[model samples]
Target: MARVLMYTTAICPYCVNAKKLLAQKGVSVEEIRVDQNPQLRTEMMQKSGQRTVPQIWIGELHVGGFTDLWALDKQGKLDGLLQNN
Candidate 1:
């Protein structure tokens, strides 16, 4: 298993859905709530180049938002990324 980091806001539906999907996949995540932390939000944007609520990183791979994450899972690439080989 790899380290999962997610930059998320409190009221984002996509963030909730992303977390649920990750839970279903049995992946433990470290969530950073950027809604209250401006610095983290800025860091997330700088790191991912996306001004989005859910900025997910499976190890060093930027997995993008909820839709992108789901696409990876559907393509069966998410698990491999999570394994971080």
Candidate 2:
């Protein structure tokens, strides 16, 4: 399986949902709290090209936010991504 990384804030519902979805897949996420560090938020923006909480990376693949993650799952593509296939 691939490593999961997420840029999230303390009170973002989307972030919570994203975590829940990943958890359902039996995946562990390394969360970076951008709310605690302005610089980290900036880095997240730079990498994701979006100023949004719950910016996710499954291995080297950028998965955007909760909506994108959910879409991928609905399309039956998220598991392969998580498995690094």
> Which candidate achieves the best lDDT against the true structure?
2
Q: Write the per-residue lDDT of candidate 1 for residues 1-85, one digit (tens) a residue.
A: 8889999988999999999999988898899999898999899989999998799988888889999999999999988887773
Per-residue alpha-carbon lDDT of candidate 2 for residues 1-85, written as tens digits (9 for 90 to 100): 8899999999999999999999999999999999999999999999999998999999988989999999999999999999873
- Alpha-carbon error at 61 in model 2, in Å? 0.6
Error of 1 at 32 (Å): 0.6
TM-scores of all predicted structures: 0.93, 0.97
Superposing all C-alpha atoms, what RMSD in Å does each candidate have to the true structure?
Answer: 1.0, 0.8
Any runs in candidate 2 off by more than 4 Å, and if so which?
none
Q: What is the lDDT of residue 35 in candidate 2?
A: 98
Position 67, candidate 1: lDDT: 98
